[model samples]
Target: MSIQEARAATEQYLPGLIAELKHQGLMQLEHAEPAQLCQLFRRSNAAGLLIPQQYGGLGASPRDTINVLRAVGSLCPSLAVMMTMHHHTIATIVQLGGIIPAAEDLLRSIANNQLLLASAFAEGKPGSPIFNSSLKASAVDGGFVLRGTKKPCTMSHDMDVIVAGVACTDTGGVDHQGFAVIFAEGANITREPFWKTPILRATDSNALIFNDVFVPDEMVLLAEGANAEEIEASAQEASISGLCWFQLMVGASYLGAASALVELLVCKRGVQDTHLAQLAIELEGAHQALLGTAGTLEQRQEADAGLYSQALCSRFSVQAAIERASNLAVELLGGMSFIESEQVSYLLAASRAIGFHPISRTAAAPTLADFLRNTGSTVDAPEPAHV
Candidate 1:
């Protein structure tokens, strides 16, 4: 089906989700049970939100995907945030193409069966400073044996599949780099409880331990050579769509959370408060900027390195605006607001999540600065690390 037809069909699913969550008192429920939420997601057909149409999924366009997530976030921000990692991982795999035989099968499986693929990629690893992992892939007769721990993989407990990047030394002794996805119910994988953050309590962002896991040769996607010069050259190229799409989609989720409160303020005060009105305007601007970026990306046929900066800058902009809006919302509503409803309070906490994903404001500064100075300048990204 065409992208337009796919979008129309997907739109039919959104309002029902919003209404169902609200009806079940699941919207903004504190400490939501993960299993129940996952089941709701399954019933809603949300697992196929980004999967391709030919593979039996909705195959929503980038902008359409973000819009759906944004709508979902307006009611249930936890599910929205938890699933962002799922979309991010799949989008990156789709961008990387069929180079990884494993990724190809995994994507089709996600589409056909509506699988929840959790991210087991590295974070907080020392030295690499990127999403680079300490996992070493040893060459076996038919596949490679990988061993390492991925810090804080989102949806660790509920995911059917796990995807992560690793450093592998090939038969030639050259360090080849690629991402690996494996079904999570297998024996080689171990999930640890690590996500203790109260705000995103439902995210289940835990640790994943890989023990002598065997990844067949077909599943290892080779993207970049593991060398300083090769990495500096190709990093910006891969950064094109994978991470930019992430920033845009994730930023929208947080914006939806803050937008909920903004609507409440308007309903209560109706612009009598000039300061709150101004904040509302800023929120609108941020939302529009994100929408425009998503549209621009959806129309692109090839990855543009320049867009990396645009997407990051837009994400941080949305992040700051949501934070400001969240604070203003509380202040305008006053102590009575806190006493009457805890929604705004939880939203304020959720707004902080805009900065949790990497290429965070601090990390993106140098890359953005370099991109501004020269679009030709290569900015090494944190994920899809060559080494």
Candidate 2:
């Protein structure tokens, strides 16, 4: 389907979102943190976009989800990036919902109340693995007490729930990696200024300090492993599913940002036909890659290392297209356009932020190489520490 059609479908799920965002204007949306945009999202019941219908949600399909993200990215790239964190968290919770009754209840509450969720997976350290969180947890009487911090936690200010990866030490002294669902209510969570960068500042990605935060047993989901190295098969599968969804949606969002620039070119008629065609081909190719990967995952109705590898490959490809398209669009738009307005420059900077996301090209190279060499290899394996 066309981008227009995709946007129209997005409107069906998030009514009046695009209109309201436009009303807020591009400069305001891009320059400041997205508290108001997030509120608008909550009002539009966007929290239920991925929740199953049975759980009082929209149960939007993967294709529709990608479309909606792309539409949002075109308007405000930060919101789109933050929403990927939210949606991916939802996907993970839903995948594990069968075994966790509390998580299912949480989903219903999220759908009914339009509560926003934030993810704290990456710790913002160089060469650190994505899943290897520094947030520490110690076993306590009814639950566990969390300590440490999650830097660059997207949706930090407005999130009602924060799902964080924790390095937990159990009563038996077994150390493992797991997720902790910390509710905002009565929790000891605090925010600190962390995201100092001007690029994508609207995401509100700051440091969330869990100061002796108490998480009950019901709010924790742990993988079956004697140590971090031996994560259970089921947990690994769920993680693969969540990560695949993350890559697809995140890639589409940046594509939309690049498309915004290309659309401006088309509207102004400033570029030659051949140049326009080149931009279209790159952007459309990236779009189809995302859609095709989403479709494959949907049809399979399951996630594995192979599909996850494909998703990573598609995401990197999309990243390359975004960079190329943004560069070309800015150059073709001319210096006058650059000096006159922030639209071209802002989008260029924002679209390139996709490369900064987890599983960077450098990190995934060896894993991808392994996958390419052996078709039966698992892409869900832990990344090398040096990445």
- What is the C-alpha lDDT profile of model 1 across 95-211, one tens digit per residue? 655445565667777877768878665484332233466677777888778898887777778888777777777667788666666777774888788877778777777788889
Residue 380 CA displacement from its true place in model 2, Å: 26
- Model 2, span 129-213: residue lDDT tens: 5677878988789878999988889878888998888887766877777888889877888889888878888788888888999
Model 2 misplacement above 4 A: 171-173, 224-231, 376-387
State the TM-score for model 2: 0.93
True-structure lDDT of candidate 1: 0.71
Error of 1 at 108 (Å): 2.3
lDDT of each: 0.71, 0.84
